[model samples]
Target chain A: MVLYCEICSLPVEFCEFGKSFKKCKLWLQSNNNEIYNKLYNSDIKSSLSKEEEEKISNSLAKMQLKEERKLERDLINLQNSKILIKRIPRTKHKYIVAIANLDLLDPNLFDMKKTCKKFASKFATGCSISKNSEKKDEIVIQGDVADEVESYLREFIDSNGINIKIEHVTERFTNKKK
Target chain B: MFKKFSKDDVHTRTNVKSSVAKTLKSKLVSQYPKLEDVIDEIIPKKVPISLYKCEDKIQLYVVNNEILFYQQFDDLIPELRLVHKYPDAFPSVQVDRGAIKFVLSGANIMCPGLTSPGAKLPEEDWPVNKIVVVYAEGKENAMAVGKLAMSINDIKTINKDTGIELYEYLNDGMWNFRD
Candidate 1:
């Protein structure tokens, strides 16, 4: 019989119920530790000293803090990172700068319309924002602004002290369209 | 697996010649011969077809605003759910739970997944080297469409790897492709 996980919709064999699927496992640990522990460690009962419990909790907090700091560092590095600018193929030199995974980004810090306007004034005649139904925002420019937009975004974001990284969706490429 | 396509580039055909329509219909019928009876019904006379030449290698065939089929690398294949609309249109094989991740990630269906206990295959006339749809064992929706790399008998008998070479699946360019 085929089995599936209620959580992620993955097949049960490829899920936590079976062997070696870490995605659901990680999701369970983060979202519902009780269920995760029950399913995986249902029979195990552990007795620990007060000092040991305190140490475990402290270490877990430390690990979480470390992860948070690493995330902050990654965000900071994104400001100085080179932007990926690309020309949308099959079009007449129409360019686009796609920024995906917006869910991971702070919505307050990033403004699609504001960024589009800034992109339009410097590089293109005008810009349009394509707001994806899937929540990703794409900024479309009429002309080539790959280089200028990258530097402009880096400087703008860095100066504003917004905890975000503006990355060009695709790698910068010279236009083969004549 | 998906590439962005502009809506402006889609070529809408308001009317298709009876001769052209017959030929196009026949082409689909030839690839999926079992659909010969109902092919004409689905693709009625002068049925509107919107052709989107998105990338150099991929072209999308949209009907009723939903992508019914796609042509990639010179081969025309129907979309998964489109195949599901007519359940018996093509032969289907079910993959066990172990193989869903790889299939969704664009990996070819492995032999073990299909030969596994929970997997199911057609009793007869497995379409080999032709387009067939694949469904995850417990899921009602067909997840992918691929050319069966090996016949069902061969797949069951041969203890080898890589069963179906999936061309398009959920989240692939064809799935997300639209005008």
Candidate 2:
């Protein structure tokens, strides 16, 4: 199997071409010392002349720096984003849980439809992916499982290596039994 | 072609019948005879193949959650990951170090990049429309896969303009696409 760098998700030999070369190098050096030595210590000379090599390295370094900055900006934006789980009172003593802002998470890793199905089975309630007033996709659970959903979402986010806050809100109808 | 592809482009996904999978394996073998040895290992018979019909008539064939190859018309273009697994199975061309960034950005391979001192082309002139893996000057793993826009001889003589129409490359939408 080809060894892949954890940081850049590219083959170890091609890490130099990726945006996170320095991080990939550190990760490889710490995880797989044998492969790291073979890749870095070996004198595999390039065919390009000194000036051409220098120019390419300079441009690559600039591009990598830009990519790193973009990554930092995205992380900051993610930190500001939050998932909101609202428990709305429907009829007498009936409530529904609506989860919003999950799209902030990586859609590739977390599928909204799959998560809806999981919630449906986990709480034995009807759940579906629907668009909210803001035209964003949100999961609507048929019952008041806000607390359960909050804990599950926290676990899910943590498992995916993302740090985001989840807030729970309860809507109180004027004609409530309490 | 797949520079801007995303999950929204996918229209439908269905499992390929075992019989159809057998025919696909044979077709792959015919295209790349070298793959005959490891075809079984690459596409195990027991595992089912998932065919994803995407926008622009592109069809991605996935097995065990990883995309093995994709078809856009008649050619069965191997994904870069698959090419990395069996680098020797496909006809390949190299690009100079300076051209690596452009190729990664989904630019068509220029003739000069292929004929440069750092690059290498096969001795035998492959005809136009041949599918080839693209390797960078210093990289061991293949970075892209594409079809030759012109005959190899023409690329050598003309030495200008587009040479290979890059279909997929490292960090492109298709490469980053996760089912």
Candidate 3:
């Protein structure tokens, strides 16, 4: 906790920085040390002139904004840190495929017929969808790897009875690439 | 020593104010080779990974501005070797800020056919403890992810909601949190 003047219960962090030292000097010149110190030590408020009130409010607002910005920056940092990727080699004959902004699904979570593309991305090689997602689903698969990928997904979705139903695309994503 | 600060001390106009920026920047460079030339040397980066080692299995997480490798710290040097040079589990994969950005932008990020959203732990408090990304379709040389940035309506605005939103993309690609 920092000490402040009885006239304004601001955190008197002025001593550390020469820049703010003048403000502390001013406060000390007016108020008695004991009363000022008591007020500073306690979380008490003091009457201020309109101008002083504006300054204090401005300071508090600026601090709050800084805190929020810090929060956002930290969130970005955390997102950058937690984000993961799986390595897939670029091979011939097989093409890697991915979809963005899953606009094809009925977010109502009840409709299924219009959800063709969603299912394709999920069950098919390029799909990577999950129940935890209420929005912003995407899918990606590489090359003819979909067949192998399909088999791969089969193992993960086993036993729980959530076999991903991929609409058969006669021309595999491999043929479409060329 | 944290203290109640006022705007007088803050540089609101110019750049990152975090002390950890430099640390994160270095770590991004040392860990991800492709980004060495792209990142400005004067920004706060990630810590150097060369000194850290993987205690257990590690996952490579990527986002818009940085990449982080999540691993248990047992023998720091060995893990550095594994992630940098000799990756036994998933070879030839390097994590960086661009790849992370690309992934978060909704590009397809690829790894081994198998990947867990990763360890059940929060990096801080967000549910994004582990993410699943794949090498994007069409863009095979790069890695990307299906971003959790936009909402269903936002995706609909673009008329295509089947992939990650690119950061440079003008409309839907930018990450926006909507309830």
DockQ top scorer: 2
Q: After superposition, which runs of candidate 2 have C-alpha atoms over 4 Å from their true positions?
A: A42-44, A86-97, A105-111, A114-126, A141-163, A168-178
Give the fraction of reference interface contacts each candidate recovers: 0.00, 0.52, 0.00
lDDT of 3 by residue, B18-51 (tens): 4434555566566444445654532225423221
For candidate 3, write residues A1-178 as lDDT tens digits: 2234332222233221122334554676575566446534654232334675466456545654665578689667544432112223354344444333333222444223333354556555334443224454445444444454445434533544442333323233333457
Provide the lDDT at A48 for model 2: 78
- Give candidate 3 misplaced runs (Cα > 4 Å): A1-178, B1-15, B41-133, B140-143, B146-179
Residue-level error in angstroms, candidate 2, position A71? 2.4
Worst 10 residues of 1 chain A by lDDT: A11-20
Docking class of 3: incorrect
Residues A1-178, model 2: lDDT tens digits? 7787778777888788789988999999999999999999997677778898888788889989999999999989888879999999898699999999988988778989899999999999999999999999999999988988888988888888888899889988766556
TM-score of model number 1: 0.50
> Where does candidate 2 clash, by residue pair?
none
Model 2 chain A lDDT-worst window of ten: A169-178
lDDT of 1 by residue, B1-179 (tens): 24334454454434445675567777888777888998766665556866666545566766667777777775678876566578778767888755765687688988888887657887885746866788875555677888888888889899487789888776555554543
- Candidate 2, DockQ score (0 to 1): 0.50
Worst 10 residues of 1 chain B by lDDT: B1-10
